[model samples]
Target chain A: MKFFSLLFFIIGIQFASMAQTPESPAIVFGPVFGDSKLQELTYYKINDIDSVQFTALKFYISGVELIHQYKTVWKEANSYHLVDAFQEQSLSLPLNVPTKLKYDRIKFNIGIDSTTSVSGAMGGDLDPTKGMYWAWQSGYINFKVEGKSNLCKTRNTEFQYHLGGYRFPYNNLQSIFMDMPASQLHVVLDLKKLITEMPLTQKHHIMSPGNEAMLMMERVINCLSIKK
Target chain B: MKYRIIIVILVCILLSAFHMATEQLFVAPENWPETTYDFSKNPLTLQKVELGRKLFYDPILSKNNSISCASCHSQYSAFTHVDHDLSHGIEDRIGTRNSPTLMNLAWHKSFMWDGAINHLDVQALGPISHPDEMGEKIENVVLKLQQSKKYPALFYKAFKDSLITGEHLLKSISQFMLTLVCSNTKYDSVMRKQTQFTTQERNGYMLFQKNCGSCHTEPLFTNLEFENNGLAVDPTLNDSGRMKVTGNKKDSLKFKVPTLRNIEFSYPYMHDGRFKRLSDVLKHYTSSVLQSPTLSAHLQTPVVLSSNEKVDLTAFLLTLSDKSFLFNPKYSFSK
Candidate 1:
């Protein structure tokens, strides 16, 4: 009877542990215009006349963390995700967090950090082959948004903003903190809000890292919000 | 007990394999400063260094595969293009500045005439992406290397992964460059009391210490600081050097101080290669130093060298050349 009870207890403990440990929680990014989901290279109606089409929309999301009651409960190891609007897979970021973990907020940086920027070439999403690193100088392009608009005066009516800088007096890295309600972890990046805030025609191209990049980077993070 | 014995033997085998993989490939010359490169991140190995050497000579890094790093930086000329005032690149394109000599680069804090590149690993990106130079993107280069028959195997042998990454590629190049130590010069011999300098050479050394030692410091032969050496600005090129990088007027006309080692073969000199001969460089220091607000503090007090003193200085400068370094078979192209 004692041996049988012990076996039953062990099996019960295994089942209990299995119940406690569920699947890994995931974070999904939803890039949308005013009312609809964003489609790459497709013209979106902004107003009565001007329509903008995004050829490329990409940004780096790094230093991911899960916060509970204002304390960090869990953090991703070497977390760096290059979120691309063109790629379907890149939007759904997989977090290696236990489903049992509790968190009220999700915190992350919108760009590459200063330390990683100076630390030579890296592989995976941080690789120079990803077309995100500057060739003439040493630094990563934190956020790249290239598109054409009928409103612009330049050739091809194109506007390109490649925002990144890790150095002082011009660091473009921005931190974001969003509340996680009901464990959904879905973040919405509204492109309409970003475009509406800035004067597109005048501030069309911002290629290098500077004060302009800092301003554009602010606009980038300002467009992100929790999809509750 | 048998299982335990087998485990012990397996552990021994594993330990030996690890030791062989990380065996020291670079030994720093005694008493030199600690290298700036973080070798822990990319440890040196025999396979990686050999792979880097092959890559250094290969023209596959260029756009049309017509130009290689060796085209502009020949080993015989101490790894710099000789007689070319400006760097000649692919399609006979002329670069804005002179191609700096490559020697004892392990000590360099930054690359390029203007100190634009912050680290050595990212230095190749400048030339590779420059329209006049290689005119190739790093993405295309990685793709080409992956598709190549020999590179994938070579990369696997070096990094233990057949998949070629930019990190592995750059780290391997750094391993080869770290081995280009030039400490076998005549001046080095004299310093070690292996030989004595001629009386004229000794006098020239004293003059050098007084006049030029501050900017071009000892041992490494460069302080590794950017300074405006007072070269008259070329009206046509109108290059502002370090100022363009920092966007500060205080840094205007400041260029990285070139190492005096291997100066005999590595010329024409200066950022623009304006001075063809060592004598012309000396003349510029003595009489032709263009005075500007950003001129190096050391050159503020004018250098006055007599004609005979110039000859002694030239003789002393030649002693800085290391035949062993210039002709090292290890640095040569291999199949």
Candidate 2:
């Protein structure tokens, strides 16, 4: 009788532990060229005339928050992630949320904040060795996209955009808010819309912080959308 | 009884450890202003300082391992490359401006002549990645440091992590730089009533107070403000100084007023190292101040000084040199 009671207690504990386990959800960022997925060093036909191949696409996503109704439900601590198109693991960011916390909206910044920009050195994704930092002027690069297009008349037909500026009149940090869909959060950044909208010939190279970077950042913000 | 003894031993060890940990790493000179460097973020440790000292002297930071911070910033010349008007870098590529002296940096709010770098931690990144300088990226520098046989162990000892990161790398370098205190000059001794200045020096001091004290200031020897001290722009360089950073015409030709401390050794003077002698610098203030739309307000009025007064001022300026800081074995390369 004692053994049977002990066995019942053990089974009860197992059942309780199973009920308490929470499944962690992730926010996945997908880079796509129109309908097809974007691949590094792979050429894609743009506007049927120009052939564009992306060599690199990386940007900083920081200050992540989940909003319920109008109020913030959860905020990631030290929330900064470098989403690189080349690295598969970096594309999906795991979020540790409460078991039953319900959030309707997801908000994040497309670049490092002004505060972090002047706060000296940092570790992890914000490290200066991440290639997203400008060495001479002292600021994060914010967003970097490099590619070769047939339309570009410059060296090797290349176009590089390193958009960043923390100071006023050219602060390129853009906040993105997406409505949470029924399924898991998946944000798609369509380069097709970006490449089509931006003039590839005249504005082929933008490597510093200025009016051009700010305008390019605005165009980058428009490229992000929640895929239904 | 044995357990009690063991507990007591453990407590003693822990107490001693706490005592050593609480020992101050950097102590400011008496009556000096609070340092602008935020030390709480990256507190100095002896191990880290030593690590940074090695990194400062290590040419591994350069692309071809030919140049280091010490290559431009030597210890003897107030941490600046003297005799070179324009400091050359890897492959003998000359930079646009002179390498500024690195001392009393803990009080400085910004780095570079134009104040382009906002923080000291990220200042090295500018030279490390400049095409004509070290010609290496911070990422590559980190990779090289990690692969180095000696650095990994040293980094682990200093940072307590074998894997080297840029944050730790920069912070360690900052630790070594912050330790470079330039106090203890003859001027400081006279101020402390330890000694008296010569009659000539005293007269020069009074004149300096009347003429140059506003911008050069005292103690740190710099007001840390930007000024265009009437230098005619070099058409070859076309360097616009602070105006390039701010994009404001009002800041045209303005450069950070460098510390007057160790002026005897940190020559040639000015942003471009144009003046080779203290007399030339004095001449510029008195007779050759090129009037500009954005010249410093202090320099708007002409400075009148006789030859005797210039000699006396030069004598007073020589008192700012601190030989102890120059010859300090602590700052010198260990290996």
Candidate 3:
């Protein structure tokens, strides 16, 4: 009788543990420059007029959520991730969503929200030491893309674009929604589309958050699409 | 069974003791509004505040190790840059605006003269990276702090981890700044009914309530809102204040209304430190207010104060200067 009771207790504990554990889906994001995957110091052409070499590309992807039938299904808690092209480990985001929930769409913000920006210093990916936070402006630089290009005017032939603003009218945080058929997904950030769509000569060297930053944010958002 | 029950009770007691210890770190003044800062994110502890105090006084925050936060914000002048109109930073580089006093910051919603920084924890970044200021990056600052002999142990004591992080650095600075509460002034004593103001001060108090009370407010001595105090734009600097942040025309010429708690020592008033004395500030309010499209509505009507009233008002303002806060050894350099 004692052995049978011990067996029942062990089974009950296992069932309870199984009930508590939920499946968390992982989503991987791959940044590519046109047909080629993004690599530092790789030269790329823009509209045959501009030849650019990118040295750094980093951005923030936050507020990850899953939507179904025009309603929200799952949202990741503390969903801020800093994606650095140099850091391969940062490309994958493990989302805490139940595998049973079927979602048709995925949505996220391209930058840190105003609430987080005002909430003070945070740890993990949101730490200011990540080189993404603007020390002078007291807000995160949502997107940082730096490179060298002979395509024209600045000294050292270097072009830098740091796009971010949390205030109204010039807020640079962009909401991105992509159709997803499976819980496990991959998103592509096409730099080719961004460089080709925007005029580099007039818009390069953007460091502060404003109208130019907003335009750059829109251009970056336009280039993001789900990978097949 | 007895041992299990005792273990559970001990855990409960430990958790409650931790709760009580955190509560003791932050002491909101009697009748003051609750602090705007969310303490749960960076809970206050004695060790963290001590670490913050050390960092505030250390010049290592600068690139060249010559300037610290205390360089511009000295305790003698209520943590403001005195004598100089514009703040002097690294290598004698002059800033665009006067360094504001650092007190009652836990109630502040935004920081800096133009409210450029929305949070207090991130405010250090403004000075640390500004070319004229500390001229250091947060990453480099972290690396330096990590390599320091004293900081690693301090970090371990405050955060229980020796690996220094930018979050820990910023939060510790905030912990010290949040403790800078200047509420024990004569004005506070009178308000609490523990003492009485002189007849001249009483008259000045009434005049202040009638004229400056709307923006300066009582008790805290600041409503903590941005306003255009009607100083004509400086042709040399042309600082556009809040308009530059919001990109809105209406916010032009608007600057954060500074607290008047320590108006005595924090001389050279206004955003640019254009006024060297309280009388000059009062004179501007009475006679020198330039009418502009974006001027504050409250200042549109002249603040009429007679010569005697000005002196009396200055006397009342003097009551706000707390000697205890200025000389508090705890807030001083921790050696």
User: Best candidate, lDDT-wise?
Assistant: 2
lDDT of 2 by residue, B1-335 (tens): 99999999999999989767645456688899989999999988899999999999999999999999999999999999897888878999999889999997889888899998889899999999998889998999999999999999999999999999999999999999998998889999999999999999999999999999999999898999999999888999999998887767898999999999999999989889999999999998999899989989998889999999999999999999999899989899979
Pairs of colliding residues, candidate 2: none
Best by TM-score: 2
- The C-alpha TM-scores of every prediction are 0.90, 0.92, 0.90
DockQ, all candidates in order = 0.64, 0.77, 0.67
DockQ of 1: 0.64
State the TM-score for model 1: 0.90
Task: Kindly provide the TM-score of model 2 when superposed on the true structure, using C-alpha atoms.
Answer: 0.92
> What lDDT tens digits, residue by residue, belong to model 3 across residues B170-274?
999999999898999999999999999999999999999999999998777888898998999999889999988888889999999999988999988999999
Question: What is candidate 1's lDDT per residue for B1-335, written digit by digit as tens?
Answer: 99999999999999998876655456667777778878778777899999989998889999999888888888888889996999977899999999998877777878899987877888888898999999999888888999999999999999989999887877788778777888888998998889989998898888889888898888888999999998999998999998877767999999999999999999999999998999999999999899999999999989999999999988889889999989989888888
Candidate order, DockQ descending: 2, 3, 1
Evaluated on chain B only, candidate 1 has a TM-score of: 0.93
Off by over 4 Å in 3: A1-25, A47-49, B1-24
Interface C-alpha RMSD, model 2: 0.7
Best by DockQ: 2
